[model samples]
Target: MKLRKLITVAMACIMVFSLAACGSENTQEDAAATETTTEENKAEEVEETAEALSGTVVITGSTSVEKILTDMIDEFTALNPDVTIEYTGNGSSAGIKDTKAGINNIGASSREVKDEEKEDTLAEEVFAYDGIAAIVNPANEVQDITMQQLSDIYTGKITNWSEIGGADAEIFIVSREESSGTRSAFEELTGVAEAGGLTSSAAVSEGNGPVQAAVAGNENAIGYVSFSFIDDTVKALKVDGVEPTAELAKAGEYKLSRPFLFVYYEDKATDAGLAFLEFALSEEGQICVEDHDAITVD
Candidate 1:
């Protein structure tokens, strides 16, 4: 009978230990679930905070940067649907002036801002680098031209195609308009920024597209345009034995290159403007720069 009682007590102790083990397991499981819930809640809060940021951003600047910036803006707006962005492709100098006058939220320039053009209130952020391609008609037999030869041809010093190993036809110089950012960059890089640098007789187009079309349609025409615009329509010449490309530009091997800048007035920047700038300088925006065939700052 004592043995029977002892056996019953042992069974009771076993039940108590089993219950304690089960309870401990349940407590650990509950703690794990709580941690997972806390992490999920934090994630949801971050998503909500990102979605809450919404506003309008206005950008005005160089037509040279218009295409890339437009693509970036489209991507950025897809995430921040309520954030509005408007871009105007005025000349770079005009954009800078407008930004200074509070007419624009941000100013885009294909070239670095000149010291004389910058104000104490303004800040320059270079987002990308662009290579200026010297283009010619696809039919042109000229495969390469030195930088000095290009400068001479544009300046009317070398007016004949035969002077650069092509046919004996007269070289038609197609140039961008005076206010074009491409023109400013081209002139500066080619050492033609001095007075009467570009030939007054050259056919002047207003935008990069027009310049490309003009060169593409004329067999004897030579022009310079943004590297992104060069395709089968025109042949890009090797300057000083190096082809103008984004990689060469980034490596400083391409001479006809310039920075793509975002100029803003720090004091005048709004919350939307600041957010947009952050997005532009982000990795995603840099990817857009590469997608557009320009070199990212990084």
Candidate 2:
């Protein structure tokens, strides 16, 4: 009887050990299963975030900023295949008016919003800075001019290139139209009156390309254009001894620079508009600005 009782107790101990082992195995399996489920859920969330967003964004404004903005839009749309962007290169004033009137989703301007144009309902975002290059014909020997000299030249006080150290030739000034953002920024930077500080004497070009063409064709012509527009056709002169470069402009060393702005009405903005604006302020968008020869804002 005693041997039988001892045998029974040993069997019971073996059974308990077996049950504990089985429980331990099942607990490990359950934990592994839960970990796998959590990983799968995290992967799904990542996939959802990577999905392309869809919408249409409408941009209208400054012709000076059109090319850069278009380039950026192209890159943005490439990443988000479902999104479409339309840009209209009217003048800056028209862009502001259209934004206020709710005709466009966003207004692009190369200049900052004037105090009078600011309203509680309107918002401005500055994404980049652009240097307004003072260009002269390649044949002209004049290399640099001071801000005061530039102001005087635009104001018609210095009519000959010889007055500021150049050849004995009359200074033929080329200027953008009055409605141009480039013209506005140039006048404000140089503290010159409207019409490129001219008294109806300067030749008016409709756009940067035309202004470049006019200056390139005339040996004695001088004009201010976007830094991106400067090429072999014209020589970009240093102002106040500081070169007009995007880097210098960003560093605040270049005085003839202006902000690249996007204006919109807060109440009128669509989801697509808001998304595009966010993208425009993203790292990728700022890279696009740098690629287009503009200074990105920090």
Candidate 3:
């Protein structure tokens, strides 16, 4: 009876060990399956990113550039169908301020960094070359003028179309407001001292389109805007015997030419910001520049 009892005890112990081994195998299989599922989930997330784009891109500054971006956005949207672009016609200074404060994703500037504004960790990328033009109403007989004359008119030294050339009418010195990037660029070219001061007898408008419209609407009006803004309604005058043109501007023959740049946070190298900026500089994007009546770098 003792031997039989021992035999039963041994058999029971063997059964327990066999059950534990089976349980271990099942646990290992479950862990492997779980790992495979986790990997699949990670792959699905990547595929989703590849399949669709969804984000709002805010670009602000240089109404002149904004003109081009509006059309670019139309084309970009057609291709992307998922990304949305929003642009504002704020001046370069205002745009840069917004960029620094994290209010805007991209800031369009017509010139390089200023002394104080350079303190931020933002990055700048030049996408196009821009030349500014002296715009006059199409009805005005004066087709061309010199930098000296333009400076004189802007400084309130010359106040009539007759003072320069055209009809004997009061020349409304229409211009962008003091906060304008275009104005800053003009000031840099003509020498601020020659321009008198920010407070001149000129009529300052809120934005570039207004400046363009004001000149186009009034027969005796004169203003300065980007060469791109010179359309059928207004005439672009020469500066120092040089026309504000792409070719002339590139050779430095055009004195008022400047670079159109895109400003962003310094991390632009590794963000969606890089993609848009790359597109802006791409061959296809450069082609779109003319759609808005502007010149492209390439």
Top TM-score hit: 1
Q: Say what the RMSD of model 1 is.
A: 3.1
Please, what are the lDDT tens digits per residue for candidate 1 over residues 209-263? 9989999999999999888788999999999999778998899998889989899
Measured by lDDT, the strongest candidate is 1
Worst 10 residues of 2 by lDDT: 191-200
In terms of lDDT, the poorest run of 10 residues in model 1 is 187-196
lDDT of 3 by residue, 1-298 (tens): 9999999999999999999999999999999999999999999987675455557788888776776777667766676666777898778888888888888888988766688998557888887777888888878898778877777777777777887778999888887776578888887787654556543567888877788899999998888888777789888887777767877877778888777888888664334455678778888788877565455876
Q: Candidate 2 on 39-147: residue-level lDDT in tens?
A: 9999998666546466777888888887788888888788777778889888788888889888889999889888888899899999888999999999999999988
What is the overall TM-score of model 3 with all chains considered together? 0.77
RMSD of each: 3.1, 3.9, 11.3
Distance from true position, residue 131, model 3, in Å?
A: 1.5
lDDT for model 2, please.
0.87
lDDT, candidate 1, residue 181?
Answer: 81
Q: Clashing pairs in model 3?
A: none
Error of 3 at 160 (Å): 2.8
Models 1 onward score TM values of 0.87, 0.85, 0.77
